[model samples]
Structure formats: C-alpha cells, structure tokens
Target chain A: MEVQLQSWQNMKLAQVPHMLAGHAMPWVLAARRSAFERFAAHCFPTRREEEWKYTDVSIIGRRSSLAPDHIPPDPSSEAKLLAWTLASESLYLMVFVNGHYAPGLSMTDDLPAGVRMASLANILENGADLPESYFDPQHEHTIFAALNNAFATDGMVLDLSPGTVLKAPIYLLYIASGHGVAIYPRNIVVAGEDAQATVIEHYMGTLDAHNFTNAVTQISLSAHAEIEHCKLLQEGPAATHVAGIHAEQASDSHFISHSFALGGRLARNDITAQLLGKSCHCTMNGLYLLNERQHLDHHTRIDHLAPECISREYYRGILDGESHGVFNGKVVVHPGANKTDAHQANHNLLLSRQAEVDTKPQLEIFADDVKCTHGATVGQLDDDSLFYLRSRGIDAELARSVLIYGFTNDIIGRVNMPELRTRIEHLVLERLPQGDQIKELL
Target chain B: MLTIKNLHVSIDDNGNGKEILRGINLNVKAGEVHAIMGPNASGKSTLAQVLAGREGYQVTAGSVRYLGQDLLAMTPEQRACEGIFLAFQYPVEIPGVSNALFLKTALNAMRKQHGLPELDAMDFLSLVRERMKRVGMDEALLSRAVNEGFSGGEKKRNEILQLTVLEPRLAILDETDSGLDIDALKLVADGVNDMRSPERSIVLVTHYQRLLDYIVPDVVHVLSQGCIVKSGDANLARELERHGYSRVETENTAKQVA
Candidate 1:
C-alpha cells in the first residue's frame, strides 16, 4: 500500500514545481515541500483501519495526474449558482472558480473596522503572517489534508481583531466547472478576544463535472469569542468531496458548526474541535440527505482539554434509493478536565429497503467527575405514522415524503438564521423522492 | 347503507395465521346508529379495522358493501376519500407533522376525490376551528404535532375533531371511550351526536354501556367469540349492563347446544 501511495505521489509530483514556481516566499515553498513529504509518507487509508472501516478512498488514490489548470469561466453558470446563495444585502461574498479566486464575482465593500478578509494566495504573496502560523503541516498527518496543503491554489482567509463584532456574515462559495479535476481549497479563520462572527462555506459544481474537492479549514477562537460556522455541500451528482475542519477554542469561547451535505457520489466530512480553555463550549449539528447511489460519511471528534467545558452534537440523515450514510462521533474528556458536559446523538431514517446507514457514538473519559452521554438510532419511517397519514386521506407516497421531510426538519429547525434555514429546507425537500408532491403540502 | 356477509378474518403473526373473526354477519341502513358490545378478544375492534382497510388482516371469506359499492376493494386512503372514517382505538403519535397540516392534507384529498375545490388557508382554519369547538378541543393542539405528547383525553378529542372535519358517510368508532373520563366521554359522544344525519350511518364498538347513556343507539348487538350472539333494540344494551357478559354467553351456548 505504501509503495502504491509513493508511486501515486510521484505521478502528481510533476505539477508541484509549476505550482511552486508561482510563489517565491521561502516559508511557502518549505511548507509545500514538507506537506508533500508527509503525503508521500502516509498511505491512503483502507477498511482495516477502524476510522476508515466503512469508507474506501482507493479510487481517489488511483488517479495518476493532477487536474487541468484552466477552465473557461461561464457567466450564465455563475449567475445560476449564485442564485442559490443567501440574497441578504449585508453578506460579504467571495467567489472561487476552479480553485482560483474570481475577483470579478466577489463583493467586499461594506466590511466593518478591524475585520480583514482576502484570498489566501493573495495574502501569502503580500508577505502577511505566514500561512504556517494558521495551519501547521506537521500537525495534520492525514493523507488528504497533506495533499490539500501541498497542492492548494487559493482559499479564503478572514480575521477579526480584539473586541470586534461583525454585523454580517462572510459567504465563501466554491464552484467546480470541469470533469476529472482535483481542486484543493484551504481556509483559515481567526477570532480575537471578545470578537463575534459567522462564516458560511458553500460548495457547488456542474452536473457533468466528475471532479474531486479536497478542502481543509482551520479556525482559532480566542478568549470570550464566539463563532457560528456552517458548511453546505451541494456539488454535482458525479463529484467526490472530502473536507476537514479543525477548530481550537479558548477560555469562555463558543463555537458552533452546522454541516449540510446534500450531493456528491462519495462525500466525507471530518470535524475535530479542541476545547483547550476552561469554560469553553462547542456545538456540532449536521444533516445529510442522499439518494440514487450517493454515499456520505461524517466523522467528528471533540476533546475537552480543560475544566468546565461543554460539547453537544446532533446529526441526522435521510437515505433513499440504495444510498448509504455513515456517522461516527467521538468525545474525549482528558485528565483534569473535570466538570465537562458532553452529549452526542445521531438518528437516521431509511426510505427504501436498499438504503443503509451505520452510526457509532463513542465517549472516552479520563476525568472522574464528568457528565457524558451518547446514543445512535437507525430506523425506517414509523409504520403507525404512515398509516395515520394514509387513513387521513393522504396518498401512500406523499405520506412517506412528508414524514421524511419532517424527520429532517427536526434538525433544520435548530438553525437560528431564518432565511438560511428556509433555504436549506427548500433544498432538502427538493431532493426528496417525491419532492414535487411534498412541496405543495409544505 | 352498509352490509357484511359471512365475514371471516385472520392475521398472520410470524407466518402463523390466527383467526380473529369467524363468520360475522350484520347490516345497517342510513341514519342509524348501532352499538356492538363485547368482552375482550371478541373481534369487535377487528371488524372495525377490516372496514377501514388496514393491512395484514386477511379476509378469508367476506363481503362488505358500503353505499352500494364494494368497500373491501379500495385502499385505506381510497376508502377515506370515499367517506369511510374509522376512529382508531389508539391514535398514532406523529412527532413532526403538525395536526393542522395533517388535517388540511386529508381534507383536500377528500375534496379532490369528490370533485370539490380545495380549501385555502383561511378557509381551512375557519373550518377546523368550528369542528374543534364542537369536539371541545383546545385550539393550541392544531399547532402541535399529531398526538405527540398528548394526554389520553386530548388524543381522543383529536380523533373526534378529525371525524367532524372529514364528515364521512359511514363512521366507525372502535373503543373510543376506553381511556376517557366521564366528562371526556360525554364530549366525545356529543361530537358524534352532532354529526348524526339522515345521510350518515355510524357503528359504535365499545365495552361499556355508559357511553350509550349519552348517545343512544338505534340497535344493539352482543358479540362473543368473533360472532354476534344476540341482536336487539337499544333496550338490550341496558340489559347487558345489568347482567354480565357471562350470563349472555351461557344462554347463547345453551341455545346452540340444545
């Protein structure tokens, strides 16, 4: 396996020099080189590893060449894609087309004081704080993260200074246009003490694009800062997406993450948060809707490294038409992290006999005095509920659809932003089997 | 308006078929209220379930006709749209579907089947409000999920509210008064009484005669061991209340043996 991975790395090495040639900074070059070494050292995970037991990424590793460097931009396609994003006037939009920043489509006119936002490539070229300060190549040993760092062309970077509170959210939209392309996007977000902000990352692609998106996002929250982060993946049906989010929370800081995965042939999300300060809190909520041979996996881990911290996680999935879903949530309470409170739950509903789901929630506690609980449930729509609807004159198919929508809405209802929640509700309903029929009822 | 002939019903429990109803026969005309009184496992509830087209119950030999059409041929939803309503003994709790949305969906389905226009939101709200008043139901229940976390009496009232809103041609109440207090029983009975009309027929299946004191039945039948042992006027219910079902079962058995 290691030999195969090394050979795979060698095949893609030809593109690195071209990528490196564009950057002159020594730290940037060294970071890329170190990331490449790490990628070459590790093999793509197999089912034998417990973390990868239910997912296989060999198809991703088998690709010999890097994605094509250029794809002509289409304005009509960009407009159509932008129509799905939030239309609020206060939003700051940054667009990325084919892994490169599209300055023509971005808008950042009314940003508040002490808030700085720009593309990573632009920031790095300008000699600002090195990207190494935000992301440590040595800390991320996963093959996909390493590959993303080594080959990423551009990404978004947002920073809020001390005591700064943004009145609007930052929207980062990533769009892929061509087939058989590999696009890596790296994002860095830092919040200073007592600051507050929200960030939304949306990924989309063309229907004909069979591309792979390897993305990584790192967030650092200082004391008393609060941040709400949301990621929406509505890629093309043939696309493959692998995303990772690593967050660090300081004392009394709060971080919440909402992940909605609706499209992709094979989509996987790995989220890890470290509560490194006392009295900090973190919340992770996710919803995945899959149909027609699509597969989605969500793996989350939260470590309570200090005392009096809280972590809560709730995830739900609706699978239909031979699709599959996997959810694995792990929480660890380190020694001396007393008074920690953690709760995690995952519920899934299968709409077809062929649809499947596997969910596992784990808790590891080294602290003696802590409160932690985890649970997972996978089931079909309730027979009694279906019959009740039918007996009230609803058709069988519409009844099933309504029940499914209701099941997913339980999680969507938790989203505090009404406009965004409504948009997500529409997206979820439009993807259901009998979406047309259920749309009328809602 | 309704007819049943030689109805035999069985259920498949883990591939083992068990007969629950044996050769049951009955008839009813329009504008008539009939009461079926029986002890446990007497097939009273099974008869109601069969009429409503619930799955997993096989009719080995039976014919149920309603309004000159074959009732057994339609699906449950089809039967519901065609004006056959069954108030379930144990109302199902749907956790996320609001009661108001459920009723509108149901009412619209029935209207579409009957070639009537669907109600708009305002019209639906007014219609449900009127029916809710008749059933003595709180208006807040309309916003909550269907029977989710509802008290026993509230669930029963919700069923009555649905019956009122649907306004079916044939109504069957299966043990609707089993878990209600006296006041709730009277409220439920009054709701049923309000729907009584020349074009509608009702069959009340219950174990107690107390409910009969509020909504008097036109006819009474004593069901024992999956068959009706006796059929009489409303006075027969009073007699059953005075003497236990054991006396009636013994008399019927003696007559059969003799």
Candidate 2:
C-alpha cells in the first residue's frame, strides 16, 4: 500500500520548484515547504483508518506521478470547458484550467468596491496579505489537505471586507482536462463582520478525461456574517475526487453548505463546521446520485462549541446499477453548550438490486440541556407510496420518475437560489429514466 | 357495472398459494349501492385491492368484468382512468410530494386520457378549493405533503376528498368509516352522497351498520369466510349488528349442509 501511494512521493519536485519560482514570495515558499513536510509525514489514508474505513482511495494512490502540467488550451478543450460551466452572465465567473488561471476565460473584472478577490497564485506572485494570515491552515490537517496546500497552483480567494455584501454569487469553475492531470485547488474565504456572500464552486471535466482533483477550502465567518457555499463535483467518468471543507462561524453568523456529487468513478467529501459563538446557525445539505460502477462517500460533522447555537444537516442519495454510496454524519454538542439544538438525518433510495448504501448517524451530547436528534434510513422506493401515486391516473414510468425527483428535490429545495437549484435539478434529472418528461409533471 | 363469477383469489406466500377469497359470485348494476359486511380477515380488503388492480394477490380462478371489459387485465392506472376508484383503508403518505401537485397531476392525467384539456394552476386551485369544502378538509392541507403528519380522521377525509375530485363512475370505499368520529363520518358521507348520480355505483365495505345510517345502501351482503354466505336488504346489517357474526356463521353452516 505504501508503494502504491508513493506515486506522489515518486514524482520529482521539479514541477513544484518551477511553480514556486514564479511566485518569489518567501512566505509562499515557507508555506509550501511546511505543507510538503506534513503531506510526506501523514501519507495517504487507507481503509484501516476509522474516518476513511468505507472509502478506499488506493485507486487514486496508484496513479502514476500525479502532477499538473501547463497543457496549451486547445479550441476543443475550451469548448468542452464551457459545456461544463455553470456561471451565468449576471454572476462573476473565474475559470481555472489545468490548475492555472485562465484569464481569457475568466469574468472577474466586475468585482464591486472593497472586494479583494483573486487567484492564490496571482496573490502570491504580485502583492498580497501577510504569509501567516494569507493561508489559515488548520492545526490538524488531513494528508489530502496538506497535499492540496503544497501542490495547488491556483485557486479562488474571496477576502470580503467588513459590511461588504455581494449582490450576486461568485462562480469558480475548475477543469482538469489533460490525461494524467491532478488538480489541487486551495480556496479560502474570509467573510468579515456583517459581510454576506455566496460562493459556487464547480469541479468538472469531460466524460473521457481521466484525472484526479483534490480540493481543500477553509472559510472563516465573522460576527453577524453569512456565507453560503455550494459545490458541484461533476468530473469525468474515470476521474477521482477527494475534497475537504472546514468552516468556522462566529457569534450570530450563518454558514450554509450545499454539496452535490453526481459524477466520477470514485469520490469522497469531508465537510465540517464549528459553531464557535452564541446564536450561530449552521446548515449542511448535500445530495449524491451515483450509478454504474461509481462510488461516493460523504462524511459530515458539526460541533456545537457555543451555547444556544443551532445546527441542521440533511443528506440524501440515489444509488442505482452496481454503484455504492455512503453517508456518515456526526453532530457533537460540547460540554457547557447548553440549549444547543442539532438535527441530522440521512436517507437513501436504492434503485437496483445490485445498488448498495451504508448510512450511519453519530450524535454526541455532552451538554445537560440540549436537544439533538439524528436518524439514518436506507431503502428502495416506498412500495405503498409508489402504488398510491400510481392508483391515481399517473402513468407507471412518470410516477417512478416523479418519486425520484421528489426525493432529491427535498435537498435541492433548500438551495434558495432558483437558477442554481434548477441547474442542479437538471443534472439530477439526467440520471433518471424518462427524466425529460418529468419537467411536465413538475 | 360490475360482474364477478367464481372469484377465487389467493396471495403468493413463498411458492404456495394462501387463499383469501373462494368461489365468490356477485353482480352490481349501475346506480346501485351495495354494502359488504364481514369480520376481520374475511377477504374484504383483498376484494377492494383486487378491484383496484393492486399487486401481491393472484386470482387463481375468477373473472371480473367492469363495463363489459375484463377488469383483471387492466393496470391500476388504466382502471383508474376508466372510472374505477378505491379509497384505501390505510392511506399512504408520500413525503416531498405536495397534495396540491399530486391532485393536479392525477386529475390532469385522467382528463388527458379522456381527451380533455388540462387545467392551469388557478383553475385547478379553484376546483380543489370547492371540493375541499365539500369534504370538510382544510385548504392548508393542499400545500402539505400528501397524507404526511395527517391524523387518522384527516387521512380518511383526504381519501373522500380524492373521491370527490376525481369523480370516478364506480367507487369502492373500504373501511372509510373506521377512523372517523360521528361528525367526520357525516361529512364524509355527505361528500359521497354529493357524487351519487344515476350513472354512478358505490360499493361500501364496512363492519358496523353505523356508516350505512348516514348514506343508506340499497342492499347488504354478509361474507362469512371466503364466500358471501347470506345477503339481504339493509335490515341484514341491523341484524348482524345485534347478533354478531357467530350466529350468522352457524346459520350459514346449517344451510350449507342442507
């Protein structure tokens, strides 16, 4: 297993020196060096680890020398890139191709006043914040997070000032098109006091473009601030996706995350949030649809570190064919965090006999006066529910599609953005039978 | 409107057939109301399920004809579009599917089958609002997920609401009187009475004669095991209420021996 995972260690540091030399900032070099040491020390996780027991990433570890290359963007690659893009003209769009900023394809010129938004590489190369404050790396980092920090070439950074409110969401599209390409995107969002922003990140690739994408994002929300982060991972059919998101919310702040994993042969996402102040509200909603030989796992945790905080988590999955899906949710109400109200539920619908799901809910309540409830259910379409709908005049196929659509729409409905929700609905529809006809039913 | 001959029904348990209905025979004319009374596990619900084309039950030997067509050969939706409606004993709850959307879709699907144009949102809302008044149901329930979090009486009222909205020619009400109080029962009965016309027929499946008091049935049949042992006018339900099923069973067995 060590040898198989040594694919990253076996890769020459040649590409790193070249990428680092472009950004002569000493802190940039220092951060990269420390991250590399951490990455080397921890190595890749295996099935033996409790947090990753259900997700086996040996397939990713076996990749031969996973590193990004500056492949010249061709006309067809650009076309393919645009096909997977989810940004509208009304929103600010940033496109990163092959782990480097594609300035010609980006739409960041319309940023409002007091907004400090740029790519990480550009921030390091030109002039930027202090090294210690630029990247707020958590003390306890996973191997994948360390790897992303050490090797990422470019990523979106939205450093909003106090009282700044983004009228529209900022969209970031990251594409890994070239074969054998591995894109490590390290995104950071620091929302100051009373600031509000919505950040939409989409990781995508063509159907046959084999690649690996390891993304790490850290978000810090100040008092009274609100941040909604939505991510859609729709990579190629043979791609591997491993992502980690950590958020810290202050007093009276609101942080919401919506994660949709619909593609890739192997994918795993770990999202955690800490309610660090009184009256803080945090929500984590996710939906994953997998079929064929694809496998997806979602691990989510919410810690109520302050009194009288509220946290809610809801995740649903639709598994078909021979695919495998896993949902593990944990909500912890720390000691003295009294009056903490936490709720978590995970439900899955299996469409085929060969499809499988592993679901579990872990709730820890150390506080004496707290309300925490968690439930996990894995099942096929309810036979009675199906028959009830069918006993009406609805056709058999349309009834089936409507039930599936309703199952996923439960999560998508919480998105609040109609445009993003509609697009996500379309992506989910493509996986259903006669899904096009469901538009009429809706 | 309906004809049943030698209706022998059974459910498949593993590989063997567990019989529920044995060699039953009956006929129902248009514009008539018939009440079927029996004890628990007497195959009353199975009969309604089979009529509605529900799965998990097999007609080992039987023939059911509806409007001169073989009712057993139709799918549930096909039967529904063809004017067959069954009010389930335990109404199913469908989360995430609002009652308004479900009712609109169902009504439109039936209308499309009949070559009629579909109703828009406003028109459908008006129609449902009017029907909700007749069924004594809350208008707020239309926006809620179907049957979810509904009380037992509310679920029964919802079933009656669907019967009124769909306006099927033949309605089979299976145990619609079980979960309702007297007030709700009268309201539900009035909803059914409103739909009663010269072209429609109603089949009431109940254990007590109480529901028949509100909506009187022209005739009543007593099913003892898998067969209708004896039948008479509405008085038969009154007699069964006083004597219970054991007396009727004894008399039925004596008659069989004779």
Candidate 3:
C-alpha cells in the first residue's frame, strides 16, 4: 500500500513538466507550477476524509493518466456527436474536441454586440490580463481541481458587457474522443452589471473509452446581473467525470445553477457560491439518474457573506440496479450577515434493494437573525401512488415508471427553459428501466 | 352483469389471518342500480376493494363473475380494461401526471381491449368537455396533476369524470359521498344518474341514505357482519333513514339467532 501511494505521488509529479513544456507565457507557466506543487503536497482523498467518506478517488488515480495525446476524429462519430446538439436555430453553439476548441464546428455568426467570446488558448496567447486575474491556482483544495488548473489545454471564455442581454442561449459542447486519456477543461464567464445571459455546458464522450474528464468553471456576476448556468454530464459508460463550479455574486445579482448527471461509470460534482453583496440571490438544482453499477456524488456549499442574501438548493437522485448515490449540501451564514434566508433539500429514490444512497444536508448559521432550513430524505416509490396508477389501467411496470417520473418532475419543473426542460424530461424518461412505456404517457 | 356468491375475504394481521368479509352474496342484472348500505367496519369497503382486484386481501372462498369471466383471476389493470371501475373512498394523489393524460391513457387502454379505435386529441377533448358539465368541473383542472392538492369535492368529481370517459360496464362507488357537501353531493349523484342505461350496471356502497335520495336504487341490501340481511326497494332506503342502523342491527341479530 505504501509503495502504491508513493508511486501515485511520483506519477503526478512527473507529469507537471509535461504540462508546462510548450507554454511560453510566464504567468501561465507560474500558475501551472504553483498548482502542481499544491497537488503534490496533498495526497489523494480517501474514505477517511470527512468530505469523501462515501466516495473513493483511488480508482480514478490508478486508471487515468495526465499525459495528453491526440486521437484522429472519426467522421461518423462526429456526426453522431452533433446529433445530440439542441437542434434549435436560436442556439449559439461552441464545440470543443479533446479539450481543444474546434473552430470549424462552432457557430459564432450574428452574435449580439458587447459580447466577447473566444477560446482560452487564444486569449492566453494574446497576453490577455482577464484570464490571469480570473484563474486562481492558490485556491486548489482538491486533487482534481489542482490537476485541472495545471493541465487544462483549452476552454471557453465568455464576457458580457454592462447592460447587455443575449436573447438566445450559448451552448458549450465538450466531447472526449479517445481511450485511456485524461482531459482538463477550464471555463470562465464574467457578466457585467445589469447583464443577463443563459449558458449551458454539455459534456459528452464520442467513443466507448475508459477516459477521465476533470473540469473547472469560474463565474462572476456584477451588480444587478442575472445568469442561468446549466451543466449536463452524459459521458460514455466507461468514463469518469469530476467537475467543480465556483461562483461569486454581487449586490442585487441573481445566479441559478442546474446540473444533471445521467451517464458515466463514476461521477462527482462540487459547487460553491458566495453571495458577497446585499440582496444577492442564488439557486442550485440538480438531478442524477443512475443504473447498473453506476455511482454519482454531489457536494454543494452556499455562503452568505453579506446581509439580505438568499440561497435555495434542491437536489434529487434515482438509483436502480446496483448503483449508489451520495449527496452533501451545506448552507453557511457568516457573522454580521443577518437577514439571510437559505433553504436546502435532498431527496433520493432507490428502485432496488441493491441500490443505496447517503445524504447529508446541513445549515451553519452564526448570525443572530437568520432563517436557514435543510432536509434530506431517501426512500422508494410510494406503493399507494403506484397502486393508484395501476388501478387506472396502467400496468405495474408502467406505473412504476410514472411514479419515478413524478419524483423527478419536482426538480425538472424548476427549469425555466421550456425546450430544455422538455429535452431533459425526454432524456430522463428514456433512462428509466421501463422507459418505453412511460414515453407514451409523456 | 355482475355476480358475487359466498365471497369471503381475509387479511394478514401480525402473521395471523383475520377475516374481514365472512360471506357476501349479490347479483345484479343489466340496467339495475344496487345500493349496499352497512355500518362502519362491516366490510363495506372490503367488498368494493375485492371487486376492484386490490392487493393485500386473500379470498378464502367464493367467486366473482363479471360478464361470464373470472373477475378474481385478473389484475387490477386487466379488470379495469375489462370495464370494471371503482371510485375510491379516499382517492390517491398522483403528482406530476396530468388528469387529461391519465384519462386518455385509461380510455385508450380500455378501447384497445374492446377492439375499438383509440380517441384522438380532438375527439378526446370534445368528449371530456361535454362530460365536464355533468360534474361542473373547471377546464383548467384537466391540465393539473391528478388529485394533487385538489379539494375533497374536486377529487370526487374527478372520479366521476373518469367514469364518464371510460364508460365502464360495471361502476362501483365506495363512499363517494363521505367528504362531499350537499351541493357537491347533488352534482355527484346527478353524474351517476346520467350514466344509467340499459347496458350499464351501477353499485353504490354507502353508510348514509342521503346519496340514495338523489339517485334512487332499484334494490337496497342491508349488510350486517359482511352478510346481506335484507333486500328491498327504494322505499327501504327511506325507511332505514327514518329508523336508523341500530334497529336493523337488532333485527338482524334476532333473525340470525332464530
């Protein structure tokens, strides 16, 4: 065990120089070096850690490597990948293949004014100051985040000017195309004062490969700005995904995050939002559907750093076969941050006895006058509800699917985008055990 | 259209089988409405549940025949598709499933079973709109989740709407008047009365005679200890209302002893 752990540390250290070999920018190289040092200083998390008690990352370390390699794109596979796009004329699509921007596949025509969108590599090569200021290497507390910062090849950089509102949504598509390769994707979004936009990050794997995706996203909202961000992970069955989202909201700003994880062998998502100004509001909603030995873990934290800030979070999970799910949510109200109102809830449904779930919802309040509430529940479908559906001429299997859909509808209903909601509803139903029967009902 | 002969039902209680319905016998012909009135805990609801093919009940003896088919052998959904409808005493709330979708699926299932074509969207809408007037249901209710956050009266009325759409050969109403007010009760009774036809049979199970006042039954059966003690006409319902259930219980006990 000791030798294996030592070799794991050495393996990560050896990849640092390879990560910064071709980078010419001093600041970018320094950032990578700092992130690699931090990653080397801390060992990979285990079940002993409180935050990782239910999830173990050793399998990821043993199976995935850091060295980057290119895979020739298959035209048929690329076409198959494009079929999953939102197929709407109003959508502004940005495509990334193997963590590098694919200009030929992107659609940037007719973009609204005051919107600056470019690849992260392009901005870095141009000596842009925005990427340097936004990327934080010292804040890497997790091994995956550290790895993402040190080795991220390319991602999307979106900037919205003050008072700018984009009528159409922006879609960022990340496709993993090769086997046994590790890809780091870094995305940054900055919305100026009174600006509003909706952005969706869709990660998919084109081949049935044993791959790993380590993603990091940073979002900053200026005063009175509002943004709706969505993250969807539907990788190949043999893929492992780990993602982190960090958001900061200014006074009177609103931020809503929606995450749906439906595929991958093992997946973990961590999100944190800091309400730094008065009257800022933040909402987080997530859903995970797993089956056949799949595992998913979600961790969310909301900090009320100023007075009159509000936070609401609700996450749900459905596990079938031998799958497992984990949920951990926390809401914190710092001192002097009075008038903070926060609500958090986590619900899980297990379709089989072999399926399991662990949930923890917590509220830490230091302010004297604050309203914070959190709850967690894990159970199966209501037998009465199932019988009710069966009594109305639906078969037992179809009835079970209907009840499961009903369980997830609570979270899906929170989606404000009708087309996206409908698409998600269809995807969720298609993943159900008896999905065919439920399709007619939907 | 329906026959029940010496039906006995029992349920598992702490690993011991406890009999809820000792023996029940009933027969109804086409175009007839039968009222089975009994006091509480006299197996009134059990009989309705047994006929509807609900689980958790073991039929120790007897049989039920509907249209010359073995009713007890079929599943709940199968029985439903074969024209058996039960208006629950306490309707279960199913969230996220719209009422219109529920009815449409059920109606299509029944129609397919009877070798008939399914109703399309336009035809289904018109049919439901015409039936909505019978129970005075709001058009918006059709789009809402089935019985979710619905008032007691509204839930009962929704059941009536389902019955009207399915057009079942045998309809069983189990204490449908329990939670309804006078006006709502009148509306429900009118809905039941509107469904009466030469090819349909109705069964009304109630504790009070008020529901019978609006939709009078051709035959009234007094059930005591899960056995029908007396059978009479519509006047018997009024007489029972005047005399109360205690008098009938005493007479039933006396007759059993003799």
What are the runs in model 1 whose C-alpha is more than 4 Å off? A1-22, A67-72, A75-81, A84-90, A138-141
lDDT of 2 by residue, A404-436 (tens): 888997999999788888878888888788677
**How well docked is model 2, in DockQ terms?**
0.59
Q: Could you list the CA RMSD of all candidates, in the order they appear?
A: 2.3, 3.0, 2.0
Write out the backbone clash pairs for model 3.
none
My TM-score estimates for the predictions, one after another, are 0.95, 0.91, 0.96
Q: If both were scored by TM-score, which would come out higher, candidate 1 or candidate 3? A: 3
- Interface RMSD values, listed in order for every candidate: 1.2, 1.3, 1.5
Model 1 local distance difference test score: 0.86
Candidate 2's displacement at residue A132, Å, is 2.9
Complex DockQ per candidate? 0.66, 0.59, 0.66
Off by over 4 Å in 3: A1-22, A70-72, A75-88, A433-437
lDDT of 1 by residue, A1-442 (tens): 6666567556677357345422577777777777767776765778888988888877776665454355435534654447344433568888887777887777777788999998887887777775466446644736788777777778888889999998677888888877678888888899999999888898988888778899999999999999889999999998888999989999999999999999888889999899999999999999999999998999999999999999999999988899989999999999999999999999998878999999999999999789999999999998878887888888898788788877887788877677678778888888866676555655
Model 1, docking class? medium
List, residue by residue over B20-134, the lDDT tens digit for candidate 1.
9898989999999999999999999999988998888999998999888999998899989988899999999887678987888889888988899988889999999998998
